[model samples]
Target: MSVESKTNAQVMTRVTVIGAVVDGLLGLLKIGVGFVSQSHALVADGVHSLSDLGTDVLVILAAKWSNEEPDANHPYGHDRIETLATLILGSVLLAVAGGIFYDSLQRFFDPSVAIELGIAAFAITVASIVSKEAIYRYTRHYAQLLNSKLLMANAWHSRTDALSSIAVLVGLIGVSFDLIWLDALAALIVAVFIAKIALTLLWDAMQELIDTALPEDQVTAIRAVALDVPGLRDVHHIRTRTMAGKTLMDLHLQVDPRVSVSEGHEIGCWVAASIRAQFQEITDITFHIDPEDDAEMDQEGPTSLRPLRREVLECLRADWGPLVDDAQIRLHYLRGAVDVEVVTSQPVTADVLKSKSRAVWLGRVTVLHPTVGDN
Candidate 1:
């Protein structure tokens, strides 16, 4: 997944390298023993083990490349490299499974395909089972510690090898009783397990590549966290997606319309901080500060079209004349119009108010004068 730290990446690399070495030894030993004993099931299991070497290399490369810092060209970082590697790993498994299945089917139909087994085949299968299982446990422990889904998937892949070896072992026992078909059957079963694991990995990687949203419960929790912030009037338009197990989110945070820009920004920062503190998976957050819900305004009519401050001020100066020049003007763009508030220490009669009413875009204008001190 997101190998944000060099230490985690090193752990992933070391684990995968160890698995690769083990896989190489077991793959060769099993294949050699299968040839000597004429056991197709052991051969199939050996092929599966060999396939792990390829994926182990893939994992090592992915772990290294995916942990790279965001560059000028790749601003989102290299997380997707790990995802792509996973997809490729799945495809490799599927291909290996298909080959094993075809070979097994041929052996099943051709009774001339002699099958034999002995203590060597049994010993190799047992050794593979024990070794692969240990690797699975070791990799899975670090996967959970680092929160790396890719590493965990590899761990399960190792477990599948152990399971397939068990199937092979059962077939070996059947061969001692002169049951030749059981070897082919065990090979077919191993193919099925590999295919199942492949399909699962492929599905998960595809979902991530397509930018699927996080689970509903997690999104709901994020929304709740944002709403809990004291200065937030409302939070909406919350969107979330994951990249290599890290979540990235964006949402709109509504605040008092009259609040200063700095205050609204501060509220957004607090909301982001609270969510980050609660959810460790969230890696990025983008907040859109909103004075009012733009969705609600759209229901009545379109309110997006409005005059800019420069145009509004020019209009005000033209209509209110020199009285607007000396006045402190505040313009609020809401509900398809501008609400102007003029604060000045000058008297304003009905005639002056009526003069500024010519502009249809102006909603209301309130004039205020300085008051004398009473105490």
Candidate 2:
């Protein structure tokens, strides 16, 4: 949800504008020529190009909104706006394919329909093929550079249209040779291609909406980065998802039981930065530091070995020889067990610190007293 860099906004704008202009001009020429010459195949291809124009508008809006910094309502930023655009793009492609297919099927059923071809139609159909293919290449190149899923969908969408125009050109040639059924067959093939692209895009976008994990290699790379950091014992519960083509992750990092809290926190920060440096697409990472796994956690609440505070005090006095009345006891309830730290001013021996009777009664015992330099 941080501020989007200027470079991303610039690339998205340039690619979208190029697609809109090229698609608009080509769509108009093909549709006009198709009707004047009574070429249904060219008209169908023209409609496909027009659909590209519609998606270009969606891309523009998605980019604008998604670039906005995180707001009160959308604390994650408007990244999902791009995903929504992708879904809409897929649905529109399917609808266009269905309509074209239905029209082509009708032509097959009706044999007496009049068919005509013109030299001008030939020129426009060839032009559509060349222009659309160029747009596809242009869009695809930038898509790879930006690592943008939405733009890549649009790129393949253009390619489908371009290939469909090739079908149109074949139909025009069929008319010249008096093989009228060829035009209908070509249109049907284009519909299949469009539908295939649509289904793929929809499936990928839906997975993201449901918070699917990244590929195994990507997750493994993240793990490698974290485990390489110093003072980290192990990592677990790693999770990842994408929003606006950027990966977001969260994981639990286990450290030594004796490490200080600040040191653990600093280590977590370093790990996050290291992963991000390796994968520029990773936008955020949340780290939960754990001294050990919570194995015996009770769903109800915190339960101590000695349920009564007085009982715990009596046991502590018996094990440690005697207790100072002013000693402070801090109970940490975790993983269905309590870690007891008794703050004292008296010195205790290592032998007494490792007493087996106390170990048997209390799972974990630690005494916090001043260092040797303290008076």
The candidate that achieves the highest lDDT relative to the unseen native structure: 1
In model 2, what are the clashing residue pairs, if there are any?
Answer: none
Instruction: List lDDT for all candidates, in order.
Output: 0.82, 0.77
**Residue-by-residue lDDT tens digits, candidate 1, 2-23:** 3346887899999999999999
Give the candidate number with the greatest TM-score.
1
Error of 2 at 310 (Å): 14
lDDT for each residue of candidate 2 in 61-141, tens digit (9 for 90 to 100): 787777777789997777788788889888887886897687668767863442457887778878878887998899899
Regions more than 4 Å wrong, model 2: 1-4, 31-48, 111-115, 295-335, 342-362, 368-375
Clashes in candidate 2: how many? 0
Q: How many residue pairs clash in each candidate?
A: 0, 0
Error of 2 at 319 (Å): 12
